[model samples]
Target: MQSTPATTTTKYPDKPITVIVPFSAGGGLDLTARSLEKLAPKYLGQPLIVVNKPGGAGAIGWGELAGASPDGYTVGITGIDMLLLPLYGSAKYDYPTALTPIAQVAASPMVLAVQANKPWQTLDDLIKYAKKNPGELKFGHGGVGSFPHLLGEMFGQAASITIEQVPFSGAGEATAALLGGHVQLSFVNPMVVKEHMKNGTVRVLAVTGEQRISDPVLAQVPTFKEQGLDVILTNWYGVAVPKEMPVQVKNKLSEGFKAIITDPEFVKSMSNVGLKVEYLGPQESQTKWLADSQKLTKTLQDTGVLEKIKSQRK
Candidate 1:
């Protein structure tokens, strides 16, 4: 049985608690971590400090967390790429076993976008074009094994077409490349690309969710399944700490995050930036993570990306 993390009864954190981000300062993860820093201190009784350790698709920061003291003073933000990177050969981190989940903060479904000038207006149009052109159609993502990159693989299978993938260092760069016509298409998080979409820089072909967002601005955008494609992928964000943290500290961290995640003001602030608040504490969050990771790993295996990993494990 998995050992449960104990709630922190003894007040830790004589000084500031640090929240490490595995990406640059202006990315979505960095921005959300900063937003949480603004509110987390009130519930945890210690001011939160955000430290960026960007590199290796998040291996550097995650590696630092793995080596840090498990005293609940250090926790960090990880997303879908945390699970996909290993399979894609980007990193060797075993996220499922390395970090203990505290809570899930928010989730934004991926959007299949095309340059505004592209002739493809719908997913079907893009699919047809991809089938006709084979590997001519290109798409951009943050990195080789990032969520968007693997998501593009799933998309190729679901749409039964071929596409060339171009990887960037981060979403901001990927968005810029898409806008600059470096890539004709991209699978981006709606929250990150909402402004560009609204400004007419890119056209949203479909959102990877079952229902459209409540935002009036996305009312006309259809879902991928609605357009006859089968896929549901989201850029999920959450808080996690070193696996060996004491139960008391773990629960305190979980409870503190739960409080902030459900707060109206916190939710509004995150939503204002296009991140819809979705809270799942510890056990629930872990289950979701495991399930999603399993699905993603399975997709990788079936798609041949997991071939080397499987052989090594065997």
Candidate 2:
């Protein structure tokens, strides 16, 4: 047999890059990804494309990105649900661990909101009613096992009530459902519900974070803990590639994204849409992802969902 020469691959961004947004167009994640798209080519010297792969509560698109070649040409935009999906057996691929953390783009915690005409004025009122009539009240989310889903479960546990859970595709849909009286409440990120809230279509009850969000629309709403509920959660969105991506490619993507996140125009755009600006480079993102995942896993284990998921996997 004749000896053959070894083949070497060229550097990334050698051609067009595809950035996948695992949600519908016009949503918070899609908007941020598109905003980054405008500035990324300036930094990387190559054309970037935004592809929407919305379904399965972001699992369908995430799986597509996971199976893509680890050449750094394919990347994805994901949110907090990426951390909770697998624990509920919804994701087709393991997140956090399967995706290489390039850098965080933006993050915002979920806020509990009710229909404008609903009688429950405060978080306490809602809890009291739910306890009196367990499972009579419904709370909506982006989808089953999403951030809102977990938040609903946690609140139910804390309040000692049974809350009927309703899942939608995104916050837009969830907002619509809440307004249309399909559901009584939702724990949605303020970014997605800002417009409806401004018009008084939906009423915010309380924020789910440790501190109250700075948005003027939510200035009156208090944190869940401040209302006597110890529950705390955050919704963060970030960009990532396959875990096996080249280090140089990851570094370039991280620097570009971090730069875009801190850009004056980008920050303004995100803030206008109610997204809080918080940039986490690769190392910090990885550390947080691991720690958050551990916390979520423990929650699942306590709920008996982890063993249920493993049994289904087997």
Candidate 3:
């Protein structure tokens, strides 16, 4: 009798990998996903197909990502929302462990911005005025419980000021509200205020990063700490897969993403949009995800936002 030949398993990533982007098609996350797709064939040896799953304020997409099979084929972009949904008690799964961050791809810190036409030439001016006027000043944010909103609350707490928060559908609307003077202030992306910085339309008083940002336009902005308020929160995006993929497969995907993000062309593309190519490997990425989630939980609790979110869910 002839000996039977042994079967061989297929190599990891032999086919296209699907990356779910839980937002609209034209947003910054979508742009980053598509931009990475351009370099995937070279670095990943397979294409990355980005699927938009926009809804539920990112809950719909994040839910899908958390539920995706543990196989390496399906991954998704995870960020602040992924970490916050579970805390809000709206998530279908516990984000802290259900998903594993493969790597962090990009980041952009929020800036404390006011219309240049306003009287607050500096953060001090804004804080002092808010103190004197109490809740007279209003600020617009992407949405309730969003990073911008929570960061705004944190800032208010740190500065010992009282201000009203206006929640919009998203950052774009909030930025527009700021520009139209519907709100006296806003926590906006450095990029959102970048163009206006040139014409002196929007004045960025401080950035929400531990250190200053690198964008020529935004670098001039001091950090919250530098300005005497220790409030800091960064908007970051990273690729995440279910926490149960094969170790080798996870490592391979991490390597691919790292290569794509580090590519000079990719770096340049991100820079052009005023986003930094902030890369962290799989282990480091997962650690950062966990840390950010924990920190946000504390911030929310301290600012009464945790209870606020819980109360709203009912």
Candidate 4:
């Protein structure tokens, strides 16, 4: 009888993995990628290399990831903006379909805040003032189709108020405009304004999400739903590779990220940066991505943003 040849099982991630971040360095997405870089090695048995490909409102990097080989060596960190980009005719790749979800790592709720000296003390106060003032109140957002812009629009619609929107280059610039009194209010991540809130430079009126954030600094802030406005906006980030990667590679990547997100130290570090740890596996992330994409599409249509985009395209 001939001796049977021995089978060899290949180990996944025998080399460094590249993680593409679609935003500039030092941004939340980049920070998340960096954090994972530190923790992923423990589970993946190899270091993670983060590459920044910032441009076209995250299209450049995402497009690169979507077009990369499905060898599980290249993955990316993406957020809701990836879902909204195609709606605005700005994306080159189909989201959630062009990319395979590995796992969702972190989520942060947007906060509606104003200068500390502003008269509005609660969500009701702001709504009342805006209702009476109409376009008199100026609100700043990161950009035209940014997450904060969408949240501001949704808030305006829910409260039946007309407010002027001032778009800035980024959230940091928007927060600066708010501090300089260039805008009456702004919607931004709590982390962006947490220091200002502590110093009494800014006051958070409410947070946008289904429930209140658990952070000590934001525990007292009410949700939009608590104030009778049915709006939930959360900036979430997840890991994904080019679609059609081998199942074994996909499973390994997912398991590695799940481990990183659940690690005690990693969770604490995320919370310190005002990011809430919320883990969702591959299937769940894909489901949420599709649902959110549909919801945002309807919202843009209802708010006439879709019409504006179409008109601009012509």
The Cα local distance difference test for each model comes to 0.81, 0.80, 0.83, 0.85
* Model 3 clashing residue pairs (backbone): none
- Order of all candidates by lDDT, from best down to worst? 4, 3, 1, 2
lDDT of 1: 0.81
Report the C-alpha lDDT of model 3 over 59-93, residue by residue, as the tens digit. 77778887888888898887686788788887788
In lDDT terms, how accurate is model 3? Answer: 0.83
Q: lDDT by residue for model 2 over 1-314, one digit each (tens)?
A: 44546559665566778999887786677877877787776777677799998777789889998889988789898787788777676777788778888888787778888887888877888888988887899888776666677787777777778888777887668777888899998887788777888897888888888888898887778988888876687878888898888778788888777877888887888888888878998899899898888888777666554564457547
- Using Cα atoms with residue i matched to residue i, what is each candidate's TM-score against the true structure? 0.89, 0.89, 0.87, 0.87
- Structural RMSD, model 1: 5.6
Residue lDDT tens for model 1, 98-129: 88899999987888888888898888888888
With candidate 3 superimposed using the best TM-score fit, by how many Å does residue 305's alpha carbon deviate from the native?
1.9
- Candidate 4: tens digits of C-alpha lDDT, residues 262-288: 999998887777888899999999999
Better of 3 and 4 by lDDT: 4
lDDT (C-alpha) at residue 155 in model 4: 88
Query: Can you tell me which runs of candidate 1 are displaced by over 4 Å?
Result: 1-10, 88-90, 308-314
Worst 10 residues of 3 by lDDT: 1-10
Candidate 1 — which pairs collide?
Answer: 5-247, 6-247, 6-248, 7-247, 7-248, 8-248
What is the TM-score of candidate 1? 0.89
